[model samples]
Target: MRGGEAATLEAVLQSVEDPEIPVVSVVELGIVRGLDAGQVTITPTYTGCPATAVIEANIREALDQAGFEDIQIKTVLSPAWSTDDITDAGRQKLKAYGIAPPPKGAKAASLCNKSVAECPHCGSINTREISRFGSTPCKALWQCNSCHEPFDRFKCH
Candidate 1:
């Protein structure tokens, strides 16, 4: 790879949207952790994420289409993935997509804790978790008492 090739690859990867959340690119979701010469590193939101294979496949397709077939993808589970890995812009995009972004800095120990989740639609803090699991495994179903609207809350971990 020549100078700036890796950066170009990173930018290309930025165009690959998450399979579940199309509004946010995988890059914005913090899945593309590193971009080095001839390689891109990624960490799925969860280990058993059903979309993991899809995400990788999408990335592979994108790379091929972008003339980056020479680039390889590396999946890493160490250091783990966290809601905190989500970029600030990603959080904003999630809210705009009608899903409550998780509170930052949350860990597994606080999984049962009911932190106030602002309703994405009406921006109301008055919300309740209807179910620990939402439309997907990585989110929780929540309803806003004020807006009477149901939305998904991206689970933190």
Candidate 2:
């Protein structure tokens, strides 16, 4: 991806943070699809996600800063991204940041919007969706009945 091996490029990519969720890096969020010589592939949380462009810009800047200006950034939409793409570390970060992580197999259950989101604050399952949209388009506003605290949960994509 850079002058030689892909691991160096990976390290650089791993440092690129997600703008919407600053607590986790793009890699942790599974935005990075693959790395290889001459190119770095990525997939956004969703195709029309507003942060997609910003994410590419941020990655470009990071690559440039890490001397990977020659490596091209490629975005792919096919086989589209899913909430399952989120890494375990990313899930933990979301919880620590006071956001509920999407439940496993959330994608198929998305249409119902009935997947129970564990309350990050009180670890309770009693939560209700307050809004379909959250601070960011990729997330939904949810309120934990146990803690009475509102939190963002990545929509089951």
Candidate 3:
């Protein structure tokens, strides 16, 4: 693609929101890994998550509507995806939506130790996991000790 065409494709893709998490865009979720002449490479947040297909369909629809129907959407799972891949803007969006963002570098430590999830409402670290699963498989249900507010925390990958 020409420079201008590539930039337009990116802008269109960035405008596509995550089907499951409407508050954040697919770009902010780190789903759009690369763009080429007529292809978009993406890595879904989770392999088995039900939203993966919806996300791709949304992107496809958006691209088609934007008059870039020729652009192909490709899924690449080799490297996998980490919560750490989420952009800072995405993290803020999640917090604003009452979902706790995973801590920096928590992805590596999550396997060995429990990472304290900060309360998005009260900014308290004293939170307890209510369940390993939240509204979605990619999150955990947690309650803040300080505010007693239950919220969803993005799971560490």
Candidate 4:
């Protein structure tokens, strides 16, 4: 595979959206670690994330559509995934999709301090944590004071 082929493969992978978060593609979310002519390696944003199966299926379909019938999908657990790996564009897309992005600079240990995850609807910093687990185990539920709207907070890993 050469220039066009490599680019096409990349594009196909980029088109594979995260099943859980449809707005952000695996590529944009920084989940796809690497893509080769015959293989794709990805690290889950959350350990034991249920979306792993869907992501794998998407990768297989994407590469197969790109003419790569033989695929090797590897899930790497080392270096563990984190919300910090998500790109700025991916964060924006997440917000656009109505899901609040993770708090910037909000380390896993600093859950008490208000990070950068402003309410997507009201842009308010005064938010209350409702639950540690949201719709998915990867996110937390939060309620904004300004809008009184409840939203999911992408957990800051």
* TM-scores for every predicted model: 0.94, 0.91, 0.94, 0.89
Off by over 4 Å in 3: 110-113
Per-residue alpha-carbon lDDT of model 2 for 90-111, expressed as tens digits? 9999889988887767777654
Q: Which stretches of candidate 4 lie over 4 Å from their true place?
A: 107-116
The stretch of ten residues in a row with the least summed lDDT in candidate 2 is 1-10
Clashing pairs in 1: none
* Global local distance difference test of model 2: 0.85
In model 3, residue pairs whose N, Cα or C atoms come closer than 3 Å (at least 3 residues apart or on different chains), thus clashing, are none
The C-alpha lDDT values of all candidates are 0.88, 0.85, 0.87, 0.81
The sequence of per-residue lDDT tens digits that candidate 3 reaches over residues 1-157 is: 7888888888888888888889999999988888975799988887788899999999999899989888898999967788888999999999999999887676677542257888999899999999888888788899999999999999888
lDDT by residue (tens digit), candidate 4, 108-148: 56553345458889788888888888898778888988899
Query: How many clashing pairs in candidate 4?
Result: 0
Per-residue C-alpha lDDT of model 1 across residues 1-157, encoded as one tens digit per residue: 7767766787888899998999999999989898876688999888788999999999999999989888889999988888888999999999999998888878655564388889999989988989989888889999999989999999887
Q: Which ten contiguous residues of candidate 3 have the minimum total lDDT? A: 106-115
Q: What is the lDDT of candidate 3?
A: 0.87
State the TM-score for model 1. Answer: 0.94
Best-first order by TM-score: 3, 1, 2, 4
